[model samples]
Target: MGHPMIQLDNLDLKLSLGRLVLNVLYIKSGFFYHSMPEHRHSNGSYELHYIPSGHGRLIATGREFPLSPGSLYMTGPGIDHEQITDPSDPMFEYCIFFEALPSGRNHHERLYGRSGGDSEDIREIARLFLETPFWIGQDSRQLQHVFEKLAWEINTRSIGYRRNITIQLEQIVIGLVRNYTNNQPTLQTAPLKTLDDKRMVLIENNILYNYKHITIRTLADQLGLSVRQTERAVHKQYGMSLREKLLEARLQEAARLLDTTLLTIGEISEQVGYQSSESFTSHFKKWQGLTPSAYRTRTIVPTIQ
Candidate 1:
């Protein structure tokens, strides 16, 4: 029997990643169709599709796979795939296509080379996707929530919406990696559990409260540890040095102020605990390419326009 046909409605598109060529498609009820026929993306990019409602079938490599609600379908470079929608009740899906960068290493090197894992990691991920084409809602609601948020971001074309969509998509990718890692035997080893690390937790809370005036020595004394010990423990648990983490938190607060308040660059810098506006601007520029003023203008002015 042929796989079920899917129908979608209210299609929306967003492009991201400096617009170097990223495409996001959000299909709602009536407009559920592809303009082109079965095709292959030979330009060495990656495609990911998330099916949240209805049913469908995916035909690829001379094989047919039924697609159902909560299904995730991904095809790597040079893969040919086609989708067939349900005739009666069309499906709603979020699809994205983007170019993948080279890892500059051997297969094994690529797999374990980066913080996000590598090529072999990607292959393992593809296997998990193919194994479960239908991710029923029974799975964790967190995944569902993330997918719904992603769909919403794609559908809404607000200011910085493209950048926001890319962030959401990256979250989805990380979620998949975490989920897959949680189940794999080799990866199931107890993650340096921080939930019960009271000292680390206390230090984090203290820094959060007094981030503006925080110093390594003060934090170490409060935690009853030497400065070196405190630094080591914090780094071991969070993967970032204590100073780096504090700066990250401060920058995040600065970004929030920039987006939500009418605070000027100097005001935001002081509010976020930076003594000098120039220092704050330098730090912010390091993390985000645009300076404080430019970022705020680029991200905020579009709303008025």
Candidate 2:
């Protein structure tokens, strides 16, 4: 049977998106020698381990899941799970770890996140995946792609181009929930363009015409979605938040001007919709780790030589 898509409504996701904050997310893939350490994650994390090849056994709470190619296992925070790898054929596992702020149960919170963090009506929602059992014998290359990009982002110097991996991780967990429930979402009445696809087409056309000043609000209003919703849509479609996407556009424009024209910093800043050169410098530095002048110097120096 095919795996079911996530039912977002059942998870109360619509009510929580505005206040949700991703606290931590990390991905790692490696082969083990003898066994995994006997350890427990913080009571706030949810982890998924997928074995790509080799052999092993996952031991958690007196349960042993035989590890094989395409085997998947999940563990909740503070849940002790161990792995015994075959000495000859060591287990190669892809692991994902994450935590959502204000997602814990009965979290002591303050107003406006002054003390505890964002308001929380349901503390146990994010934790449900922790309590869920391991999913074995599931081959998911989609999940593999998510991890691959996450690993790239975490290891690379592309920090300014923010990417939200948590969203995909949440979807994966929901897919697992669907499997647990054995519920496949009903097919759509008719085939239609997805909201994300439509938005992408619109954004691309706008960018092709005028990328000098594209803001989050512009994209949000065009799609009749709130800023957060629009950002989520962008994340779903491109694996990047709208802010990062727009910044990347602006950065590209700035690069082109710097490489081709002799515009002053103030002029280039205004051309890219910045109110001041200082503001432009700060943002540019954040993305490229260099001021506009410094970048120009570096790029131009190579040409002169």
Candidate 3:
């Protein structure tokens, strides 16, 4: 029989690296008892591999690296690589495929798009990965535990498992970066002022979870920021004013409800913080070019797959 393999994709897993984000596209783990064919990833894609046990050898770009227990390595875009197991001792490995790119409205741009105006920090990280296309080292971060936990979470479908998996995936990437930079000075990121990152997380969480009743003043108090400060902060991070952000959040929730539920327009309006169905319809049309009913009809119909 062929070697057993476990694979997971179609996951909405993402993690932030300052302003940029890494989106994990797939994960695979298995024991290898055979020689694998040489292959290369597409532009902007990266494959990170960790061998927790057994023996193997990896050939990357005409360079050879030994793989044994605790072996960790990364192969980035356009790098040709292959793995061969030492048959007597098959190698067991975990691998993750991901792409790092801009997030939010700027997401359409590649990590370092043609314009080349992306953050220097992002460019630096990308440069390091490209210039050193293949990295091999021993895992000093106990990342095997993380990979194990990630597999467990994915297989068990336990409560909060999605978030748990995201966290684990984030840890895996971070651990790999740490390994790469072990002897190097800490990588500089486009600064988020002291606590700014935490503050943005809080602000976003509040808007997403409490949009129904959140107001500028209440959110300001929660962040220990004055109303003006709160407004400026939201604009700075999202390129939208506080009112626009709230409107976007409410409309987004309204659209989700429309797509997934049978609730009436009035109910959705109330649930998403609209004082009246008329107001909800008006804003929905202005924001999405479709009224609630039209939007729902477009999204809720069952499609033949």
Candidate 4:
């Protein structure tokens, strides 16, 4: 297997939601290509390669693996690797790069963490994915569908497609990683039952139903726990106080409305349970570094342009 020459078309790339990054490469039809030389990524992002139509070979860490249509390969950050495509058959592949964050790190750093699970679980998962040379001869129809959707969004640049594509890619990457993890032996740990686990579900349901009028005392009584106990449970589960989580949920909803709808800032504030525009502006500014009007102006005005 050798690297072949094919026309590479760069599609629109955007950071729509979280810290994840995505790039779609289209190898124009009829371009006979083989091989991507060994390379390393400094940013600690993992690479997920999906081959839709072609055959190839992968060389990584002194090992060679054959590539075929529906081949899926994963390489972690800083790992040098290369792929050799069969020159006879041109193929298309979508490369997804993402960083998995730790539980309590900033959004950006969390994306690059060593693993997506606990340390032990991540070690085993990473080992399995890296050791498995190539997942060839497996049906990759679902993956092909995902790549097609991504390709459509990238080429068309349809209204709101950037956001849609980013989300879809995230789901796709997570699904693939999860599938790999589930097949590994480390994820078979015994489940632990905690009082807060049950209580948090009840609390989340309550908040979803009536976030507008939610109060500490009311939640405490509804959960049949003392206010102090309820508060501790929430903090333990989410690493934030109950009040903070409530406000976060509210702000997240408000941000979505601001981005997707034509709602006025004042109206949006009220919908998210802010009693006063001033209070909402203060809180929004603290979390998002921009007041409601300013944030809307920055995010929505460009769409019109």
What total of clashing residue pairs does each candidate reach? Answer: 11, 3, 0, 10
lDDT score of model 4?
Answer: 0.56
Candidate 3 residue lDDT tens string, 1-305: 23235588755677665445666777889998766545544344567898888898886766667889999988765466667788899999888876655544453244455454566665555445434556778988999888888888877889999899888977887677777778353222221222243364467557656766788898899889999998887666555777876787678667667865799999999887878899899999999899999988773333211
In terms of lDDT, the poorest run of 10 residues in model 2 is 1-10
Model 1, 1-305: lDDT tens digits are: 11222233223433322112223322222224532123333222345666666776776655666767766655643344556677675666655543333233453343334444335545555334323322222122255566666556545668886577567766665565455445441221112122222354366455555667878888888778899988887676556787887887687668657755798898999887889999999999998898988888783322110
At residue 260, candidate 2 shows an lDDT of: 54
* Comparison by lDDT, 2 against 4, better one: 4
- The lDDT values for all models are 0.54, 0.55, 0.70, 0.56
Minimum summed lDDT over a 10-residue window in model 1 is located at 185-194
lDDT of 1: 0.54
**Candidate No. with top TM-score:** 3
* Stretches > 4 Å off in candidate 4: 1-32, 99-141, 182-305
State the displacement of the C-alpha of residue 272, model 2, in Å, after optimal TM-score superposition: 62
Worst 10 residues of 4 by lDDT: 185-194
What value does the lDDT take at residue 214 in candidate 4? 80
User: What TM-score number comes out for model 2?
Assistant: 0.41
The best candidate in terms of lDDT: 3
Model 3, residue pairs in steric clash: none
Q: For model 2, what is the C-alpha lDDT against the true structure?
A: 0.55
